[model samples]
Target: MVLGALGVCALVLGWRALDLQVLQHDFLARQGDLRNLRTEPLAAHRGVITDRANRPLAVSTPVTTLWANPREVLAAREQWVKLSNNPVLNSRTLSQRVEANAGREFIYLARHLAPEQAQQVLDLRVPGIYALTEYRRYYPAGEVTSHLVGFTNIDDVGQEGIELSMDNRLRGTPGRKKVVRDLHGRVIQDIAVLEEAHPGSNVTLSIDLRLQYLAYRELLAAVTRNRAAGGSAVVLDARTGEVLAMVNQPAYNPNNRSGVQTAALRNRAITDVFEPGSTIKPLTVAAALESGLVSVNSTVDTRPGTIRVANKTIRDHRNYGVIDITTVLTKSSNVGTTKLALAMEDHALPAFMEHFGLGTATGIPFPGESDGMLPIRSRWRDIETAALSYGYGVSVTALQLARAYAVIANGGIKVPLSLEKVDQPPQGERIISAEHASALVSMLETVISAEGTARRAKVPGYRVAGKTGTVHKLTAAGYADDRYVALFAGIAPAEDPRIVTVVVVDDPQGQDYYGGLVAAPVFGSIMAGVLRTLNIEPEQPVGTYAGVIDREGRL
Candidate 1:
């Protein structure tokens, strides 16, 4: 009976072994693989950002991030002390994190580590610790191009400027790969790639690095010299409407932003708006000229240099008995511009200003760009009409002002502004007759002459056409008596214009707050450098306008 019972047990055990090994082999293998296999991420390289000349503005560098399977790490608590020996990891903090997340599968140990440093930590061969190849963004131009190129977060995400605008094009898709790991959670075997990483496409901007540097340096100097709150400078290609250079003062370094102020991050050229002051005179005069209400030779009388409308008084610096329309712009006469606007149909001035791109966004892809305010009223007051004509009721950005001047520079055609390299000249909208535009350009040239408001804006070898603007900063209490925004907008080599630049010095302190005193020199200095850098031929003959004033006090 005992022999029979033992033989029965042996038979049952053999049958059970066969069932386990042969029938369930596939299921068991999959269960084991689940514990050892992982679908790891393959980080894709971000795109390069460059200037129109292919000079790198922003680039990415490879770095390593250390992570761990907390459960696996907690199992090997002895190794935690070993990790603490490395400067990057703290033993107490590591223990607390491991304990707090004891049930979890993963946690970050360290991030953005130098390859060499990460290698050192990995060489210790700590259990459950792993490294991932990641990227960190770097700006080569530093603060000089910070406001334009912008900066990315630690995870390589763009936050501002062109970086934010073109984030998708700059950020590539990360890939995936299946890998086998040991019991310690370290990658041990390379498996098959599930998806190939597609690196981001490179971006080429219209910004010229040379011109950007020039703009930054001169703008910084002007801001410091005038003790102004801040400033912006923009240079645009008249032919293509490409932003050759755009810069702002109080810039912050993108690479090291420890305590960067929020205000410093603004791309002021496109984002900030202010009353354009006398800078809008050219457009107002253009409106008058386009309306046929006044000829270029027509004159406005200003016996006392002050005009009153609706109990509001508009005054000029001094009295000029009677001046022609050209002289009106040359002197930046408030009385002259106010009279021109008052003579037009209420809708005519605002409609003409709209054609100049005022109170409208330039359609730049930049973030935080302001449309600026252009009030639309069903009925117009006499004072409101006067104020709008001289740029008080309306507001504009530096870029908007630049584009308006560019329209005049491009012979009354308005091209859409571009932040990227324009492959071909874009079709432009004809906003004004070329005849009137040319006449306006000729009249603007007088502003840089000796007797004009912006004589300091003159470039020695170029016939500059520009206007000076000095506006009291409007506050909640009304126009501030102490604060002023000084402005200069001009076209260089006026005979055949190539570039249009606008300079804004906000709230220049001290008695010298005039645009010609603070902003015009900045414009002249930057234009001189840009003309020489671009190899544009000098249009004015040597000594032609240098200290040579005609009998009529014109260059």
Candidate 2:
């Protein structure tokens, strides 16, 4: 009877084993997976950003994140004591944090560690500490291109400037795969991928690093010399409307995150707006020529250098008397520009400005681009009209002014500005007749000649045309009593236009606050450097100077 009972028990045990091994094999396997299997994140690299010359502006480099399973860490107190005491991890505070979150499944011990640093941390072999592969964004150009290239956040997402503007294209999709981790949470076994990672597409911006450095150096010098609040300088390809360099003073390093002010992050060239002052005179002249109401030789009388309209008086630095349109621009005459603005209907000047992209965003792909304020036709008082002509009662970003000048430089086509490198020149809208544009260009050339407002803007080998603007900064109490914004916008090689440059110096504290004195020199230096760096042929031959030096090197 005892033997029979033993046989029955054995048969029952055999049957139970067969049922579990075959009938519920999937369930058994799932149970086994719960403890050892993990869906590990496969990090994808963020795409690199390069300048037009393929020089790396921003790139991603491999990094590691040290994490821990707090529960496991606490369970192994002896190992935990060693890990906590490992000076690199900071013993006392680490011990406290682990104790406080002992129930937690995961915690970050250190983030964004270099390979060497990560290896140093891993060498401790604490029970729960693990290093996960990740990436960190790095900017090669540092503060030089900070405002233009921008930066990314801890999660590798763009936060400002071009990085933010093109975030979608610059961000990669993180993938996942199954993996078996050892008791210490180290990945030990390879498993099937759940999804493949897709890296972001690379971007080639229109920015030329060579030109960018040049602009930065000159702008920094001018701002420091003048003791200005801040400054911005922009360089654009006049033919294709590509922004080659956009720089601002008081910039911050993107690679460093400590003590950075919000104001320093602003890309002033595209976002900040100021009254353009006399810089608008060239556009007003171009409008008059476009309307066929005046020739390039159209003359305005300004015997006293002042004009009165609607209880307000507009005046120039001195009496320009009677001057032709070209001389009017060269002198930056407020009275002459007022007459030109009022020559037509009240809305004509504003309409012309709108067509030139004034008081409007330049349509750049940057964030926080301001569309400068412009009044509607209904608000056009005589004083307002006069002020608008001379760039008051209106505001524009430096980029907008650069684009408007580029349109004139390119012979009347208003091409869409591009931040990315464009393969082909865009077919543009004709904002003005080519004849009118040419006439305006010829008139602007006078501004760089002797006796003009911006004579300092001239380059010896290349003809330059630009306008000077000194506008009072608007305050809560109205125009400021002392603050002023000095501006210079110019086109180079007037015979065959190539680049447009705009320099803005905000509230220069130096005794010389005029645009001609404070900003024109910056424009000249940037233009000359850019022209030479691009290998653009000089408009003036080697011996084009009127007087030759004697053998003693005396002129």
TM-score of 1: 0.92
Model 1 bad stretches (over 4 Å): 1-28, 183-185, 540-555
Expressed as tens digits, the lDDT of each residue in 1-555 for candidate 1 is 999999999999988888778888888889878988889999987899999999999998999998877877777888777767677776777788778888888888889989998888787777878899999888889998999988888788889988889999999899999999886567889888999888888999999999999999999998998899999999999889999999998899999999999999999998999999889989999999888998878999976999998898889889987999999988888898899899999789988888889989999888999998888889888899899888898999999999999999999999999999999999999998898889989999999887788877878778889998999999999999999999999998889987999999999886689898889989988998999999988876756656743323345
- Candidate 2 lDDT tens digits, 1-555: 899999999999889998899888889889878978999889999899999999999999989898888888777778755655455676576688788888898888888988888787688787878889999999999999999999999999999988999999999999999999876677889899999999998999999999999999999999999899999999999888899999998899999969998899899988899999999888888888888778876788987988999998888889989898888888888899899888877688899899999878888899999998777767578888888889998889999999999999999999999999999998998999888888777878887776677777767678888888999999999999799999999988888887999999999998789898889889988998999999989878736644543322223
What residue pairs clash in candidate 2, if any at all? none
Error of 1 at 116 (Å): 1.1
- Give per-candidate clash totals: 0, 0
lDDT of 1 at 373: 85
TM-score for each candidate, following the candidate numbering: 0.92, 0.93
